[model samples]
Target: MTSIIQTQELSYEAAIKMCVAVTQHAHQLGVSVGVVVVTPAGVELASVRMNNAPLHALSIARKKAYTAASFKIPSFNWQERLKHKPDTMSALLREENFTYLGGGIPIIVEGKLFGSIGVSGATEAQDIECAEHAITEQLNSL
Candidate 1:
């Protein structure tokens, strides 16, 4: 018997939908945020910044999403890893588009890594909450 591995695909529209859902929830909470959705290859699919969000937040959001998509780990864990290894952390910073922030998280579905979504410009907790809501509820629900 032979087994096949079916690759999970996340269309750009789906990624955008996830981002919108997360942003809407964040808005309801009175938290302005920037969101970035990236493919598994770390390419940005869609990005949005809430009204009055910081200009730097867009860059930070993209970096966080890229970091998560590239590393296949949440940004918070990346921060902890850096905390344990300052030298390594410094080295990682030298790489382009690497951010150890709370808003970056990978979107995993059916135990397969799909892509990533990042949220910023809000409190770290709120950012993570938005990301989680999108990944766990909206994205995964599809």
Candidate 2:
């Protein structure tokens, strides 16, 4: 049997707003960063790399966002959960667009996973802070 499922997604405008907010927060922290927002299906809706951010940050940020959206959990959680399972971690790491980093966060509203945001370029803590700030602000505005 085939059945269709409908899911709510983050709008393009919202994704842009989130990316902008993350960029602003990164700037306020005196860091250049790359930010990405992805839909529930792991499709990137918006992304930005601040001037002087690391050249590799943009790709990492997108992968982080995709990981969070596809797995429905913060990217760091995967690292923590998989650390003790070497075999599982090795297998998961082989998956495309899967990153176990702190900067990726799933954006949930009213218990629904709408999408995700990822930030990179600075320390993992700083990147996570920027992503968290943007997601919180967006959720609060809802």
Q: Which candidate tops lDDT?
A: 2
Per residue, candidate 1 scores C-alpha lDDT tens digits across 38-131 of 9888888888888888888889989889998888899888877778798999999998899888989998876777889999998988998998
Candidate 1 stretches greater than 4 Å from native: 1-8
Off by over 4 Å in 2: none
Q: What RMSD does model 2 have?
A: 1.3
lDDT of each: 0.85, 0.92
Q: What are the models' TM-scores?
A: 0.90, 0.95
Q: Please give the range of 10 consecutive residues that has the lowest summed lDDT in model 2.
A: 1-10
